[model samples]
Target: MSVTDILRLGPVMPVLVIDAVEHAVPLARALVAGGVRVLEVTLRTPVAFDAVRAIRAAVPDAVVGVGTLTRPDDVAAARAAGAAFGVSPGAYPALLAAAAQAGLPLLPGTMTPSDVMTVRAAGYTACKLFPAAQAGGVGMLKAMHGPFPDQLFCPTGGIDAASAPGFLALPNVACVGGSWLAPKALVQAGDWPAITALAQAASALRA
Candidate 1:
């Protein structure tokens, strides 16, 4: 599926950080069970790729993708590991070119109109707004909407349940990426039910 389609599949995509490879399957299952199917597992841990492969094998319903992609090889590696799509905190010329040619759906990051335009010029209509809260949150998105009406965004970084509703209420936002659905404490404790509950709440924020 295209990046836009993946974004549209759910209202919120959990920005996950899995520390253990063994936690992959159960965690994905809990999120999917709670009504969220789109999952972005950030490559911040050593077991990231293994976790991606594990989730793909264990969870049929979850759409697992790789995040924190900073290099061209990361794209190829993620595709080989069966990532449905890829996300990065920011964009680079070579990285964008490689992902485009690799046919990997990528949501490169953007925090300003110029960044959005640059990604758009490279033929991407959807992008992620990194550090969304610090980048002016809803107001920044609102301002950009006037100029880039066709742009689609998934704002990530420092967003929580309380602030998510405001972000999702915006017309330019497709969804918001957050880590609250599967907090490190919850994941480490193996609290699937609690995670599912959080996912349910986030999924309900579809405005």
Candidate 2:
């Protein structure tokens, strides 16, 4: 399925960073069991690609995407590791072009209306709002909707289960990206049950 379809399926997309490859499958299974299918595994660790590969190998139903993409080669590396899609904290023309060339659906980050307009001009109908809270949260996204109704957003950074529903309620917000559900401490502890509960709670949010 397409990245947009996958992302729009839920109110929140679990932003995960798997330090141990073994946790990938169980974590994915837990999320899926709790009503989440789309997962963004950020390349913040050395085993990120292996984790992505392991998740894909084990969970055929999960729609996995790569995050923390900053360079063009990062995109290439993710595709090589079998990412279904890619997300960047910020936009770069070379990275965008490379993503298109690789046929990898991308969610480039934008912080302002001008950033939004720039991506729109580049033919991207959807984008990511990084550091969502610090970047103005739902209010900032709402402000842009009037001028760019066609654009969709996946607001990332500082979002948690408590604040997710509000952002998802915005007309422009497709889904929220957050690491709260898969907290580093919990994941490090191999607390799949806790993650599952978090996912279930997050999935209860309405757009």
Candidate 3:
């Protein structure tokens, strides 16, 4: 699916940083049960690829993806792991070029108008507004709408359940990415029910 379509899958996409590969299936199933199907498995852990592969194998309803991608090979690796899409923390020339040629639908990050324009020039209409809170949160998105009216965004970083609605309310935002739904403590404790409740609330957010 396209990046936009992936973002449109739900109101909130859980930004997962799974430490254990075994938690992948149960975690994905919990999130899906709570009505959030778009799951981003960040490549920040050693088991990330295995987590993605396991989730893809076990959770057919969840659209599993790779995040924190920074290299050309990462794209291929994620695709090989059965990731349906990919997300990068920031867009670099080489990484952007690689993603374009890698056949993986990517949501590259943008922190300014220039970054957005550059990615747009590379044929990306959708992007992630990384470090969104530090970058001015809703205000930045409002200003960006003036010049990049057609561009859509999925705001990530420094966002929680309390502030997600504000970002989602922006016209340019397709959705928001958050990690609050699947906290490390809860995941470590194997509290799938608690995680599911968080996912349910986040999924009910209005965009």
Q: In angstroms, what RMSD does candidate 1 have relative to the true structure? A: 0.8
The TM-scores, one per candidate, come to: 0.98, 0.96, 0.98
Q: Which regions in candidate 1 have their CA more than 4 angstroms from the true location? A: none
Predictions: Cα RMSD each: 0.8, 1.2, 0.8
Whose TM-score is higher: candidate 1's or candidate 2's?
1
Residue 143 C-alpha lDDT in model 3: 97
- Residue pairs in collision within model 2: none
On residues 1-207, what C-alpha lDDT tens digit does candidate 2 reach at each position? 566676788989889988888889999998988888899999898999999999899998888999999999998999998999999988868988988898888888999888887777778888999889999998998888888998999999988878888898888888999988888888788888998898889888962
Q: Write the per-residue lDDT of candidate 1 for residues 101-132, one digit (tens) a residue.
A: 88899999998888998899999999999989
Q: Whole-model Cα lDDT per candidate?
A: 0.94, 0.88, 0.93
Candidate 2: list runs displaced more than 4 Å.
none
Error of 3 at 27 (Å): 0.5
By TM-score, rank the candidates, best first.
1, 3, 2
- Candidate 3 is scored at a TM of 0.98
